[model samples]
Target chain A: MMSTVLAMAAKDLRLLVRDRGGLFFTLAFPFLVAIFFGSIFSGGSGEPRQLQILVVDEDGSEGSSLFVESLDRSEALSVELSSRVEAVEQVRRGKSVAYVALLPGFGASLSHPFAGSPPRAELGVDPARGAEAGILQGLLTQFAAERLQDAFGDPSGLQENARSGLQAIELSGATGPQAEGLKRLLTEVDRFATTQDTADGQEPRSGGQGGGFKLEPIRIEKASIIVAKNGPPNAYAISFPQGILWGILGCTAAFGLSLVSERTSGTLVRLQSAPIGRGQILLGKALACFFACSVVSVALVIFGTLAFGLAPSSWGKVAVAIACAAMAFSGIMMFLATLGKTERAVSGVAWASLLIMAMLGGGMIPLFVMPGWMQTLSNISPVKWSILAMEGALWRGFGWDEMLLPCVVLLLVGSVGLLLGTKLFRWPNA
Target chain B: MIRLAGLTKKFGERFAVRSLDLDVPRGEVFGLLGPNGAGKTTTLSLMMGLLEPDAGVVDIAESGPPTDVGVRRKMGLAPQALALYQELTGRENLRFFGRIQGLSGTQLDERVDHGLEFVGLTPRANDLVAQYSGGMQRRLNLAAAILHEPQVLLLDEPTVGVDPQSRNHIFDNIEALKAQGRTIVYSTHYMEEAERLCDRVGILDQGELLALGGVNELIEAHGGLGVLTITTEAGEVRSIETENPVIALADWNRSELETVRSFEMERPGLERVFLNLTGRTLRDT
Candidate 1:
């Protein structure tokens, strides 16, 4: 019986090798996808990537130019100057995270503490990148606040601006209590500015609490949870997990389709006529799918290690992950085979179902990048467990204790699918 | 030897095989003759243990039901449909089937080669079956069935669609197997092939066996009479039905030898016997 099962599985493997399209989906396509995504995410260096933004300066004044320079000097931001239309276009096209456009009154508003209107900066940001928009807004506010600090540092400029503001208010001809209050406030500001300027050899109160007004800059220190020595060597370590899922999906679809083809082609009837039972037949199919999955996944990991600097902390854990993933997907293959009768029908349904599983399971996108609700939903996907198990060994530096959950989940999923698939299986004529 | 006692199978309200009782003794070539829906394939499936009988048993080699792996090992079936992997070569298909049948190593290789040679597929053994012609595929199906050298072989519609040459080739292969004293059950709707090869023929209709006996025995019992035609020199034609055409012809020659320019005789065959029993031609059914 064992010999018969092995023979059956061997035959399926031989057939898979001869099918060029199946072979490509099973092996080559997954590798190429890994390389493509890995290269994109690697970013060619270990340094943290800066949030890029475009700056549009309509004010065209020293104050506005200085603000732009300060933003350009920020380590967290990479600024590019462009026209308003071009800046918005770049932000819309996802070439830049957001755009900062300074209006015409920005320069004058920066010099005059008591001005007609405060400086205005319009932000055009990508809707999909809502997180980055908040960060960009915070950076813009910090740079604008620095201008206020500069105004306080030089009281001579403040006094001159205050006298011009008071003259303009008085010439405008208003006699209301509110107008009297504003004039009185400007007169006090002029007196204070003159006194501070007249004080001899006094250094600027850049950090002093003068006149009960002082701006304290908050310095933020950056850090990472993933230790450099234990973290992934490159993005390929992260991408190969998703790539392995694609390979497993290919195997699942191919094996499922092959089952329907066998029935339609009458080869299944011939198999039944042999001295093998139905259980053995299904087992043989699952074994074949498992072997194919394991081979494709192992080959992908090996290629990743050699070509893309994927460094798994533990080879033995990697093997365990591969085995569990293969087992889970083989069971899935069996379940998928029962979805339809004809090869065309089975192929359509299997791919649609598998694609959904892949999408939810982090086969298409990295799980860490998904939203909170999506990550919670991913727990239901075998792909999530597969990737988690793989990442644990490859770069997450998860010890055996931490690896228990994913392995157990994978095994449970495999067992359940296998049991259901076996119960639902039907012969060609049945 | 193969025996099916009171074998019954049904699909919904329809009887596929009703109370089928059959026995093909050792070394006999049994032909199961039926029309499109006459339960031939169903009966074969039961014999191969692919289906369970609703109310009976199928015994092969007098050991047990074919459902038992040991009993099934003694039987082989060539289904009407061509069963093969198109992606694999003819040699690979045979080898795989052989291995599943418990043949391995040098023995497996030899039997695969022999089976391919027997099917006239040796020259194209290494070519993928997808590239093979329909006739070649049919031949390979037979080869796969007989590759294991089973004690009892069941062939269902072995010559469904083929040219005359391929049909003859299959007949020769069956004859060769029969000569080896193997118990063979052949199922087909073609009466001529049955008349040519089957040791005993069973005529079936609507899931019931209408007649079962030697080819001549069934014909003699069910066939009505022989038709004799006499054509005179003046082109006058006369027809006579008789039990003994040779005796009738002798009397006609003595009485009116010169008046009869030429004569012809038509004997009752399986076709007539089937028509006589079913009230409809086999092809019509």
Candidate 2:
């Protein structure tokens, strides 16, 4: 029986070597699929887009000019000048992410403020790009608030007034280190106020003068950017999973078709007639299919790593994952072939199953973009688990804890498929 | 010896073979003669244990035909289809099958050479089967089947689609096997082959055996009288009655039918006997 199985497997291997076209379709096609999809997901050539914002300067005051100068230093926004109508048009057309419209207000309003209503700035933005637009709007609003305080010359006056009021209350004796810290903070504010006046080219105001206020310079230090400790987010990372999924699916289809051909050609019937048991014959063919799938998987992995820079942290784990995946696919394919009585039917079912699995398993699209329900539903597909397990081992830097679930799922699916396949598999046309 | 008793097989609603009973004695060439779909192939399949019988038993020698490994070791089957791998060379295919049948190393190489030589394919033994002609491939197919040198050989339409030269070579090989005291059960639709080779022939039709006997017995039973023909000039004609007309006519018509262009006589061939029993020409069906 062992000899019969070995003989059958050897014959299939010989046939595979003789037929160049079959070898290519079985072994090389998967790597081609990987390269094709890898290129698409890696974002091979397009430049990244930057946010564009239009600044409308209706407030012709020096304070507004300072605000515009501050906006020019922002790295997040590419600022441009335009009329309200032009800015609104640009925002509506998506040419600019958002428009900053300064309302018309003369310099006389700030000199005689009565606090009836605060001035308003209008921001025009497209809703589709609303999130970024909103963030930019918040940043600009804070800038405007700072500029308004600078114009009024009372940025720290409110803090100083609160401190004096608290001192006057004297709820407890002000003899502790807390009182000394408060005094030090007040003196620093005074020094900042003095510097602000000199920087603005204004004379210092007297301490006891009526309606006198001071401006304290507050320095806003932007955060030092912390670059992420990883390679650039690539489209290939996503494409790699897709390629692996398709590669396994292709192996299943290719091997299933070969089995169907053998049945049609009467080679399988002849094998059955030999002094071999049906179980031995089926096992022989299954082993051949498994070997073919493993070859294809190896080819795909080599090409993926070399051509696309897809490096797996653990080669051993990746190999095991690929072997399990190939075996699972082989089992499913052999089962599908047995269910079919003809080559056409087997090919049709194999192709349809492959496409369906590819679609559901994030082969063509990333699972992150899929709806939660659909993502959950993908657990039923072996392609999904296999891809996830392979990606976890190869690209994702996942430890065994993270990788264990997908591997277990894939193995379970493989076992079930093998059980059903062995039971369902028939010799030739049954 | 191959023996089958009450062996039967059915496919779905159709009974392919029904209670087939026969014994192919050792050292004799047994022929199974039947038209297409007449249970000949089905019975062969059952006897080879390729298909499970719906009823009864099939045995080779003392054992049965779910033939044990020991019995399988002593049996070789040449199915109708080309069973040898097309991508392997003739010798390689023989060696592979021989190994599967338990031969190995030097023994395997020797058997492979002998098998290829038996089918007169030793010269082309190293050429791939795909490179061989249909007749050469058919011969190689037979070679692979007989590579293990089994005690009994089951050949199912072993000469189909072969040129006459190759067919004669195959027949010669079978005769040599028979001469070596090897039991053989040969199935074919060729009546002339049955007449020339078989020690006993079983005529099967519609899943049932219509007749079973030696060549001469079958002919004498179905064929009422012998036939004799003598072609001569218009003026020379004569009628002669004798059980052995060909021998008697040679002496009688040596001078009388001297102007004869051709003369032939036979105790009616297997074809005639088949047509007489089945009421239809073997070739017509």
Q: Judging by DockQ against the true structure, name the best candidate.
A: 1
iRMS values for every prediction: 0.9, 2.5
lDDT (Cα, tens digit) per residue for candidate 1, span A288-403? 99999999999998999998898888999999999999999888888889988998999999899888888888888765456547767988999989998998887766678867
Candidate 2: tens digits of C-alpha lDDT, residues B1-285: 777888888899888888888887889999999888888888887887777788988888887564576777777788788776777788777877776677778998888888887888889988988899888888887777777777888899988888999889888989999899999999999998998999999988878888899988888787656656666666554545457877766775666636666556766767877788788776677
Find the candidate with the highest TM-score and give its number: 1
Model 1 bad stretches (over 4 Å): A42-216, A224-227, B228-240, B244-264
Candidate 2 regions exceeding 4 Å error are A1-4, A44-234, A368-373, A428-430, B229-266
Q: On a 0 to 100 scale, what is the lDDT of residue A248 in model 1?
A: 91
lDDT for each residue of candidate 2 in A174-214, tens digit (9 for 90 to 100): 54454444445444445665555445654333333243333
For model 2, the local distance difference test gives: 0.69
Clashing pairs in 1: none
